[model samples]
Target: LKAGVVEALKTVQYMGIPQMVVTSTRTEVALLKLARFNILSYFEDVLGGDQVSKGKPHPEPYITGANRLKVPTKNALVIEDSENGVKSGVAAGCMVLHMPDLINTKLEWNNVIYGALDSLESFPEWLSSKQFGMWV
Candidate 1:
């Protein structure tokens, strides 16, 4: 998970975009240890589950992240790997891109969620594609 997160951070860095990882993990000690291994400075902030009033499936977490970044929820783009994450983004009015997970997710929200992407490696490309517009 640490390596994957580092790679994901690198990818975002390559795109010259700022990011903040909002996690539902109980403890972020692993993140602190892993940060030394691959400190991709792109991640502006790293938030834990305890930081917000609610976890996934609620807007609070995502809203907290957007608020911390000083970016409105409407302009935020969330890349989540679980059904609950997807729901949280939708509830927050952010554009969500879901990475496939074991739990099947119903992405019923219109432009709130562009699509469920396949892999992290393909994420930047798919997100950059001119064919897909931002959430309205």
Candidate 2:
């Protein structure tokens, strides 16, 4: 777990985006073990599920993330690969990008999704075009 977290931190750092690991109460202890591996400092904030009133698919987690970043919900971009995660991000009024990775499939899309990208590698071009207000 620690090695995985360390690799994840390195990846996120390579992308130049601030990253944090949000865990639920049942998994906080696991995070502690992960911290022992010295990867905790890579995250700006580490929140436990008990800290929020709701859980996944409820918007609270992502909402809390947006709050921590001091960014408006609408301006926040959520990259979720699960149906529940997509729903939660939408409920929080965030601009969500649905990536159907190994954990997700075509059946998950129900029309409410803003956009779907083929894979992570496609994000940079898509984001740039969207930022320029060109929906090509």
Candidate 3:
């Protein structure tokens, strides 16, 4: 997890927003990562590679994520840190917020991404404020 992500997750949870993790990694690995941060309880579920027939950039992971949450892809918000993740979310018809952690984007992502954040800590504010209808 990135810095302040635990707090962000807790804050979103406190606000009663449903959250789920969509990752290309295997389900067990993703779960272990969340467990390492002690944030497993914050998400409803993790839609991982084990659960998807395809990986990031294919939209299957994100589609599965929305399905697991019982929400439409258009209504889902994806906070991503990688290029493939962003592409996957966009292809899935979800709003993607990019926050660079390990990968620094180079291509023209603004046209595809819903928003860019300096840090994951700001996601809750963006969700709470007048961001894309302010989560109405």
**Quick one: best lDDT, which candidate?**
3
Q: By descending lDDT, how would the candidates be arranged?
A: 3, 1, 2
- Please rank every candidate by TM-score, starting with the best: 3, 1, 2
Report lDDT (Cα) of residue 96, candidate 3.
86
RMSD of each: 3.4, 5.1, 1.9
Instruction: Give the distance in Å from residue 44's predicted Cα in candidate 3 to where it truly belongs.
Output: 0.5
Instruction: Output the TM-score of candidate 1.
Output: 0.77
In lDDT terms, how accurate is model 2? 0.67
Candidates 1 and 2 compared by TM-score, better number = 1
lDDT agreement with native, every candidate: 0.72, 0.67, 0.82
Question: Candidate 3 residues 7-124, lDDT tens each?
Answer: 7897788777789988788889999989987889999988778787889899988888888788888878888888888899999999888888858754698787788888977876
Candidate 1: regions farther than 4 A off: 2-8, 36-40, 105-112, 130-136
**Tens-place lDDT digits, model 1, residues 1-136:** 5225556666667665568878787437637744666663567887788777789888998999898888889878898878788889889988787776655546464455867766676765665563333422
lDDT digits (tens) for residues 1-136 of candidate 2? 4123355456556555666554555447747865787777777776667778897789898789888977677766677777778878889887777777636645545566678877766666555455432211
Clashes of 2: 0
